[model samples]
Target: MTSSSRALLFLLACICWVPVTAGAGERPARIVIDPGHGGVKEGAKGPGALREKEVALQIAHRLRSRLEAAGGEVYLTRERDALVSLTERVEMTNDHGADLFISIHANSMPTPRMRARTEGVETYFLSASASGEAALAVADRENSEAPMSRAARGDSTLALILDDLVRTEAHADSSRLAYAIHPRLVARTRAADRGVQQAPFFVLSGVECPAVLVEVGYISHPEEGLKLGRADYQEKLAEAISEGVLAFLKDTRRRDAARPAQVAGSQTP
Candidate 1:
């Protein structure tokens, strides 16, 4: 996809969703966009010296722009290049009372010597424990950016607090967001569909809203790296994400409408 082609796709997607009538009472949706890695924390690297932080931030900005144009209130965890603690990022959104949290990232593998052909987007929700190799791979790369200390590795105090407070309301919502976005991206970009999974991402575990971490593509794969580095692909990535967020809002509204109203019995005599 070229830049012009990607822009056309985004324009078309926007036309499909932009409300035409009765837009009167609709509340503007809010979203928190977290661009993974920053400052000294150069996340995963690609074949051509592309940094995960750089691409993540670019995509995050693109996503923010799209959401804002669609009448959404989007907040960014970090606007400039600076190291932000994972705990702080989640807390920021919690404090802001945002509707959803999305962390953007690119994937990398350890076997740099032997390139395995893996390319796709994977969406994740918080889990107490990650299941198998997929979970392990995610942990390894995410951990690489911020190595865990002994204190950090210790008990489950943080997890317990977050599980009780943060992730409850939005786990299913985040999963649905993931489901909505990943396929659109795959279809539009012709990328592989890694599908959505649950993983205990430390960054997402502490958030209050429905939170998800999106691995946009495999930086480790040479071809994928080239594709992701292109502005065209990034725009497509942004547009697909925007569509998913819209879907989430639409579904939430529908669900709220379908729920029975609570009636008070003889409150006043």
Candidate 2:
């Protein structure tokens, strides 16, 4: 961005806040849920032949139902085991003017030992660089299926990312959204809290609203994999995710509602 454009964005950032309303409140929350990996990308398989793609779809469907029941207007990127490009997913979110965008997938490890030992729930919001090596690895594998657009890559990428973050205030909101949801997931599922991290997730790029990617559990984990394949467990996962999303939306509304008052108070000096 040029100096003028940067100045404009910075000025807007000083005055902007997007309030998230409840589905049954003033407006319904428009949510886009993406079930990652389908078609040729079968993703990982577990000891019982449980597939990541299948598990993700199951959870997505369950999540959709729960959100709709709660009055949120939810849209799935792919309703079934269908392949959806990363670009298409972003387009759908933009087209719907979504309040939130969440991509769901099962986690996996590269080796048997790693698979056996690693089991937990993880959540992520987008960033220019990853929080650490492990988070970067997760982002890399997930991004490998679809390379990011040229603008999202290359040496000038950091500048571009910062520009977008400043323009949208999405980075800050996305982090808050992740923090609100991660704990509920761990509490509801009784899964290890793998903790939240930020990474350069391709699918999360360019989303107009707060976006997050959730790694529900390790599909390669012997016990967790079996649990993931079960209907009851899938329901639990869906229930937890829906609760988190709704909670975040409500919290966003509360936070934004107070923001102007805080700003006005600060200006009184």
List lDDT for all candidates, in order. Answer: 0.79, 0.83
Pairs in clash, predicted candidate 2: none
lDDT of 2 at 29: 80
Least lDDT summed over 10 consecutive residues: which range in candidate 1? 15-24
Give lDDT tens digits, candidate 1, residues 130-215.
65678656855675544464247654864575566443657777778778778887887888888777766778766777778889
Tens digits of per-residue lDDT, candidate 2, 1-269, equal: 89999999877543222222342346778899999999888888876778888999999999999888666788999998888888888898999999899899899999989988999999999887789999988988888776554345663775576566755777788888898789988998899899999888878977889999999999999999898999999999998888787777767777676785545456654
Error of 1 at 110 (Å): 0.8
User: Could you tell me every candidate's TM-score relative to the true structure?
Assistant: 0.83, 0.83
What is every candidate's alpha-carbon RMSD to the true fold?
A: 5.7, 12.2
The parts of candidate 1 lying over 4 Å away from their true place are 1-26, 113-116, 143-167, 264-269
